[model samples]
Target: MRTVPVAEAKAHFSELLKAVEAGEEIVITRRGRAVARLCSQRPLTAAEVLAPLWHEPLDIEAPEDRAPEPVAEWDD
Candidate 1:
């Protein structure tokens, strides 16, 4: 990870792209505050993006087992 000011980023755009291609993430900062990240663009299709959220409703039902019998005590 590396931080570069907006001016530097604009001046060395190709170098930044090369750095990103080499697996380095560059952060663009404005006034020493990080505002954006530069890295490889991985665009996913809408279906690919939302596929993980598609699932049947999880209908969890309570068990039907009978309750335990009450305890019996005998007094002599």
Candidate 2:
């Protein structure tokens, strides 16, 4: 973790982002008081990304009840 004044933080914003990307936490202070923090976000896994989609039911219409059409087999 690192602490920097607001003015310095603004001046070296890009460098601070680089540090944050490298998993460093930064605290920004204004007039000697802590104001903001910078940190990298953890990447979501495949299951975590799909969790929301699983929560809601999809609004898809069911196919009509009838005999299914046969798919033609293709010859190589």
Candidate 3:
């Protein structure tokens, strides 16, 4: 982890991003107070994105169990 002033961060944005990509965390400070953090974000797989809902019960009904919708008649 590292702390950098906002102005310094802006001056070396590309370098900071490269460091973050290499798994380093950076904290940006404004007037000596921490304002933001920069960290690498990896793409999530479909399975990973749906993992939280995997164990939850779904209330969806099968197509065969659904009521049939009425057909409308058209006049020529």
Candidate 4:
């Protein structure tokens, strides 16, 4: 982890971004107080968000004889 003043952070913004991409944590301080943090953006892996709802394959075709009418008819 690294801490830098606001001025230094502004001066070396590109370098700091590269460092963050390499898994480094950075803290931006203002008047001796920590105000902000910079960290790498972590992408969601396939397993994290793409878990299958069902494992077995099943039929998913629309019925040919399905009625097109609504259950309740409303008066216009």
- Candidate that scores best on lDDT: 2
Expressed as tens digits, the lDDT of each residue in 1-76 for candidate 2 is 7999999999999999999887677999999999999987976467655665686765789988998889999999
Clashing pairs in 4: none
Model 1, residue 76: C-alpha shift (Å)? 34
Question: Which of 1 and 4 is the better model by TM-score?
Answer: 4
TM-score of each: 0.53, 0.55, 0.55, 0.55
Q: Candidate 1 on 1-76: residue-level lDDT in tens?
A: 7999999999999999998876567899999999999976765467655656779645689999998999889899
lDDT of 4 at 19: 91
lDDT of 2: 0.86
lDDT of 3 by residue, 1-76 (tens): 7999999999999999999887677999999999999987975567655666678766786666768889999998
Candidate 4: 10-residue stretch with minimal lDDT:
44-53
TM-score of 2: 0.55
In model 1, the Cα lDDT at residue 4 comes to 99
Q: Rate residue 55 of model 3 by lDDT.
A: 87
Q: State in Å the error of residue 62, model 4.
A: 52
- Runs in model 3 lying further than 4 Å from the true structure: 43-76
Task: Answer with 1 or 2, whichever has the higher lDDT.
Answer: 2
Clashes of each: 0, 0, 0, 0
